[model samples]
Target: MDTECMHINATLAKSGYDIRVFGVGHYCFNLIHATAIFCLLLSLSSAVGVIILLCKSRTGKSFMTWHKHERFLLYRCICDISYGFVHTLDHAHILITKDHVGPSGLCALYALLIVNTCLSEGLFSLTSALNAFLSVYFRKNVNFGNKDWKLLLLLGIGPFLIAVLVCSLGVLGPNGFFCAFDSVKGVIANAVMSTGMTSAILVALFTFYVLTWYRIYTETKKLKTQLSNNGCARSATLKSAKAMCLFVVVYIIQWTPLSIYGTWQLISDVPFGLFLAVVIMTNLSGVFSGTICLFNKSNKISVSNKDLGERTGHERKS
Candidate 1:
């Protein structure tokens, strides 16, 4: 905490937030804390389950033998763990200390961690959209070779580099639930960077997934009509298409409220309902992403373990 930050907090105390409960505003103190704990536990359990599965699968085997989806899911889970860590440690400190922490390192670090994870998670969602699109349309996964440095560059380092810059602009401070851009400049930066970027990602996600499900629909109609007079739809294909839509739905539901809340935070105090909705979405994203990674398996237009291990075959270049 710098002297400047401490002075800002003193000003923020008089602005609107209670400041006693670490600027949580009028929200129920105990409720937010409880939700944060739940988020951490859910994320931990999901991560542990995936780790055990991965470790067991790797026993007496090479890592490269894995299906590409496995690696993607594991990396996404890493982001999940990042979110869980931020909520558990940072939120707890704020509640426990009752706004007494400091001009300190904790809020600064919390801002950095949360922004990095949140942005990375958005990009990861885009990765998933691309994965689904290519799996159906091209029927192959690109193997980046060695350390997956390309993906590491995109998912691992990219958002964090931007996060470092955002923090450097000196907009970090207490928001309603967590410490992030509280100053006017910080709010505008978050509006353009966080909310705006997420909105763009959402549009791209919707476009890709729609094309995928449409491919399934149109091709299924053509092939199936020739085999039967009834021209019956395949139930499994319908189910898979429905399941594909679920991921997009989850991402939209998770981020939209929070994005709206971020923009609203710029003008005036957000209502309790909107505040809680945003909190629930941001924290629970870990649980949602982990669940999708675990249960989402090979499908009709996608590859299974048997196909994944094969060297090559499909309409795809990869």
Candidate 2:
């Protein structure tokens, strides 16, 4: 009876039941796993759905269309697909035991995570760059000939350089996980990367706000000019402005919390699972943004019209 009791205790210890049940680790792991899975599913569905919708739309004249910001939406969808694939790997690595995982698997997992991080940073930086470019591009006071290309280059390069530094310095620890530093080194390295990412996010948010204000100003001026001349153009201008504002607001809300949590995790000693959960949540921001874009009444109406046109064309040909 004692022998059986000892055997059970040893089994429990080895299985991590004792370690998991007594602390927050188990719950954290479960939460991370669940969130990651959800993110992966959401991203995949959103990406595929957007691709299909884009293909069916007559207004999608090219892969990088200027109409309705189709190019930006396509870029975001691609990023979402890549992010989903990386998080799937992250989820597998976290949920499965190391004993059951191979070295190749570990490397692939780490590589994917780093790549996703880089891409996320890059896309975010591009969003900021786009905002800056629009501000300069549309400004009445700013001369096109005098526009600062150097500043644009600097803005574009900043996040990428930071991403490169983070990836380069993020050493793989003895435990096979890539982190900021191995010990103290790892902590410092992580802090640097986290700080860089946080700074980039803040800059992006600022740029978005600036662009929103610029749009509002431009639209208000246009509205006034058109109204002074005639009222015929009022409805179209208002619709365009309303749509632009809606897009900006939805994006900011979806991405802001994730940025805040990421910045917090950089300075604090957060648990591994908790950190993973936060990252997963950040990835899910794409889902929310995609949902808003896909389900907006105007977008839905456009998609429906496109679908009907395609169906009519097919039936006529048949």
Best by lDDT: 1
TM-scores of all candidate predictions against the true structure: 0.76, 0.60
- 191-302: candidate 2 lDDT, tens digit per residue: 4444455556556755766765676566667676564322223323333333433444554554555465557655654445445545565557457546656655455322
Candidate 1 all-Cα RMSD: 6.4
Model 1 residue 86 CA deviation in Å: 2.2
The whole-model lDDT of each prediction reads 0.63, 0.46
Give the Cα error of residue 97 in candidate 1, in Å: 1.2
Off by over 4 Å in 2: 1-25, 64-68, 98-129, 132-137, 140-166, 170-185, 214-218, 221-251, 262-280, 295-318
Off by over 4 Å in 1: 1-27, 135-145, 183-185, 222-249, 263-269, 297-318
Backbone atom clashes (below 3 Å) for every candidate: 2, 5
In candidate 1, which residue pairs clash?
Answer: 1-103, 1-104
Question: Which whole-number lDDT from 0 to 100 does residue 2 have in model 1?
Answer: 17
lDDT of 1 by residue, 1-318 (tens): 112122234453432133444334434765766777777778767776776676686688666555555666677678778778776877777777656335646677787888888788787677666755665567554444566777778876898998888888777666645666653346577678767887788778879877988976786767664644222223333333444455666687788887787667667766757766766776776577566655564342343322422333231242
How high is the lDDT of residue 49 in model 1?
Answer: 73
